[model samples]
Target: MSKVTQHEATGLDDLDPATAPARDAVHFRRIVAARQQVSDAEDGLREAVQAAREAGDSWTIIGAAMDTTRQAAHERFGRAR
Candidate 1:
């Protein structure tokens, strides 16, 4: 996938109010959809980790699935007291 430049990412909200509405509408829609996909992926990852813990899975196993160190996984997703 092509990378979004800092200008494109940060200047999305700086569009002119009097310009063509269709142009801004398309750009806004694309940004919203991209953000939604990210949110969904984060939710899915959290649910998967919770399910793993409930299944008595070890941090090492979960880390392997996520391609990270065991301690990293625990630090990232472990329950807080």
Candidate 2:
């Protein structure tokens, strides 16, 4: 079975598991690990945004911290707060 690099596999659907059981196992494991990392980061961001709101930080400040517009930050994380 051939190994699929990041450029080769556009997504998990391109991971032909049946043809490469061992490699697929490793790829699937790594995919889960990467996904967990992303999920954790997202949760952390949400928590931080909520905390900032509770601390009276305006959307403008949060937006600057996120390198985005004030409206964008408020639109994305305000509801969570």
Highest lDDT: give the candidate number.
1
After superposition, the stretches of candidate 1 with alpha carbons farther than 4 Å from their true spots are: 1-22
lDDT of each: 0.88, 0.87
TM-score of each: 0.67, 0.69
Candidate 1, position 67, lDDT: 99
Residue 74 lDDT, candidate 2, scale 0-100: 91
lDDT of 1 by residue, 1-81 (tens): 999887788885677768836444688789989999999999899999999999999999999999999999999999752
Q: Write the per-residue lDDT of candidate 2 for residues 5-75, one digit (tens) a residue.
A: 86567675665768856544688689989999999999999999999999999999999999999999999
Q: Relative to the unseen true structure, what is the C-alpha lDDT of residue 45 in candidate 1, on a scale of 0 to 100?
A: 95
Candidate 2 global CA lDDT score: 0.87
